[model samples]
Target: MAQATLESAAAPRESAPAPAEAKPRRSGKAATGLLTTVLALLLALFIIGPLVWLGVRAFADTWTYPHLWPDSWTTHWWQVVFGDKALGVAVQNSLFFAPLTVLVSAVICLPAAYAFARFEFPGRRFFLIGLFAANAFPKMGLFVSLAALFYALNLMNSILGILIVHVLGTIVFMTWIPSAAFAAVPRSLEEAARDAGASKLRVFFSVTLPMALPGILVAAIMSFLASFDEAQGTYLVGAPDYMTMPTQMYSLVLNYPTQVAAVFSILLAIPSVALLLAAHKHIIGGQLAEGFQIK
Candidate 1:
């Protein structure tokens, strides 16, 4: 009877369930998921909150601090922005120059980028470093120097001159993108086209250019934004005669009410927003890293 009792006790102890290990794992997973959800919500709020506030304020008739909502809403601000002749002129100039800058930059940068990608020679690294250095240099300093140079050349207050400056500002980015894009393209494709009796230009246009179009488009969009948002260079070089949306916006901020400024801000953002929406897939999917990989 003693042996029987001892065996029964030992069997019960040995058969006892393993301390519910899965419960702790389940709790840990739940905690991690909750943490991830909280972080995502915070990030979304941080980015989207300002944009929502800006939209609300743009149409609000009267919004003051500590107020959860505006007293009323109206389209008066939109009317005011559109009705103003000077604002119209500024918009027109900005529209013209932004695209012009993109075109000029592409024309100049594409060939150079292709050259850098395809055939590297002496001073190639030096040139690339110089391009990067120029991009990294202070815009204010560059604008000041450019202003002086433009003034000396009698190029100030002209659209062409401003276009040139914008091109210079964005060319490095444009060039680098296409260079990386071209590098990512298989050389075998170009060689095959050439073997199939296609000229160098034909091969590039038919094979390489198409392959790199997404990257090029992304570069162009970036260049357009850079040129469009440029204030210091535009003000310094094209000011007093050539006024763009950015300069106009600055002036409005200095002289006009908040509603007017808000309207202008929304108007200024429209094109950029539209472009992003239209080509978002390409912009997001573009292999920027591959473009920089030379070998």
Candidate 2:
């Protein structure tokens, strides 16, 4: 009987059915998940609330504080946005300048970015740092200096002058993106193309450029939007003759109707939103850091 008792005592007690503490651990996890969800919802609301408000105000004929909803809705503001002659001209100028800036910036930045990615030489690091420095410096200072230079050259208020300023603004982003894209491309692929009797130019266009196209497209969109939304440079350089949507919107905000300004804001947001939505997959999938590994 003692042996039997000893055997019964020695046998495991079916692992004790896991302690009650396990329930608290699961509960803690559940609480953490709930908190995370709440925070995400709040963050999303914070970002989207103003945009929703702008849309509401754009349509509402009479919306003011203390009201949960607009008293009445109308398309009057949108009609004003489209029918206003000055706004039309401003939109046209912006359309012309922004795309032109992107084109010129791409032309200048592509080869420079490629060189930075593919070659190492004297002052390369210095040059790269210089690019970053140019970008980092306050736009006010740069535009102030450029204004003086443009005045001296009789380029002030000219499309060319504004284009030059926009190019300067966008070149940094353009170079950084394509450089990463080029660096990500395998050198072996280019070598193989060369070994197959392809010329350097042919290999680059066929192999390297195609691989980096997604990044290039993203860079182009950014450049376009940066130039499109430019206010300070356009104001300083293109004002009194050339006016962009942003500049016009700035004036309207201070002097014109709030509803009209809201309408302009919505119009200005459309192209950027459309482009991002269209290319979101490419933007998300493109690897910016992967190509930096030299091996």
27-91: candidate 2 lDDT, tens digit per residue: 55556656766787899899998899888889998876799789999999899889989999998
What lDDT score belongs to each candidate, Candidate 1 first? 0.83, 0.83
Question: Which pairs clash (backbone N, Cα, C closer than 3 Å) in model 1?
Answer: 180-291
User: Over the stretch 168-252, how does candidate 1's per-residue lDDT look in tens digits?
Assistant: 8888778888888888799998999999999988998899999988889888988999988988888887777999999988899
Error of 1 at 197 (Å): 2.8
Candidate 2: misplaced stretches above 4 Å? 1-22, 286-295
